[model samples]
Target: MKKIALAFLCFLATDSMAQVSQDSTISAKEEIEIIEKDTLFIDMAKYKLTIPNNWKIKAGCTEEQCTANSPQDTLGGFDTYIESINITVNKLSSSSYTAEKYANFSIGYLPKVVKGFKVLEKKRLNSYSYRVTYTGSKNNIEQTWRQYYHVRSSKVYIITFSAQARKYDHYQPIMEPYLASFKFK
Candidate 1:
């Protein structure tokens, strides 16, 4: 496993005011922009992923399974990341199953494991690939997830992106390239 932190602070926090007064509204002349950004590129044998600089690499992660997590919010919940991506490499026990089958199996079982699981979209490209987007809640926090499944060289690679429901859209751009970088070795 080899990792590189770009160490590029992409944000230019040029804000004149920290908080807007509840009673006051800014005029059209006022423009405030705040950006929090950084990313790390990690290259592994099976895949190469880019993650936010603030995200911590999970202790359980190895060459077989890799996971990176975003920081918890001010509320301080136990759920690992307000947003996260997990990639797992699974070896086939038998040559009978396709990635489609593995993906569907996971989709079917997800609701039982994650509370309030509701699938919003599902796309099957072929017998070899599948993708799904869903929302679920765990530990009192609602979350949205987009998962991808693909098979190559007799191995099924599953990549999952999870985020707080409120932040999913905001975080999607950041997670996109990371998810797309995965492929079976």
Candidate 2:
């Protein structure tokens, strides 16, 4: 009787553990599904990206234009977007122009034109890719911005992500994947 009782208790514990593990696995899968649901693939003339579905292309801008704006609400007595992503293609002035050089030149120029410009971080993604993060004010509201650059075949692709400064961390997960999904075609 004692041996049978011990075996029954062990079985219950094992079953309970299995249930918890299964629940955890289900939760993880659901999370992945949620993230996948938010993604939208955008194909442009020379590039493509997977952006969040909540973002909409600005009026009069086509998918090929590579400009999208996040949902907006009136904040600080002004109409403004919560975030925006703009992808622009620029013809390289010279064949020798490199992504790193373009990135550095772009960041170096920001302070000259952007109000209250402050560099937060600048890092190279690879030999030919770079990213920069900075903060500035527009219409008296502080904003944070990130720019990722990829140079390919005499064209420079610039992907700029901008959000309210306070919301930058909250939106990083969404933004990072969108930037990562950028591909040159």
Of the candidates shown, which would achieve the greatest TM-score relative to the real structure?
A: 2
lDDT of 2 by residue, 1-185 (tens): 53453344334333333221112123435545644764455565567776655555544444334576665534455655568889887889998898889987987888876799998988889966888899998778889999898888887888899888877776666467667778877
Off by over 4 Å in 1: 1-39, 72-81, 125-127
lDDT of each: 0.64, 0.69
Per-residue lDDT over 1-185 for candidate 1, one digit per residue giving the tens place of the 0 to 100 score: 13322112112111211223121132222211111123354456666665554566665456568777665544334554556788788998767778778877888899887898898888886777788889988777888999888877777878889888877875666466557655444
The alpha-carbon lDDT assigned to residue 99 of candidate 2 equals 85
Pairs that collide in candidate 1 are: none
Error of 1 at 28 (Å): 25
Candidate 2's C-alpha runs over 4 A off are: 1-32, 62-64, 73-80
Judged by lDDT against the true structure, how good is candidate 2? Answer: 0.69
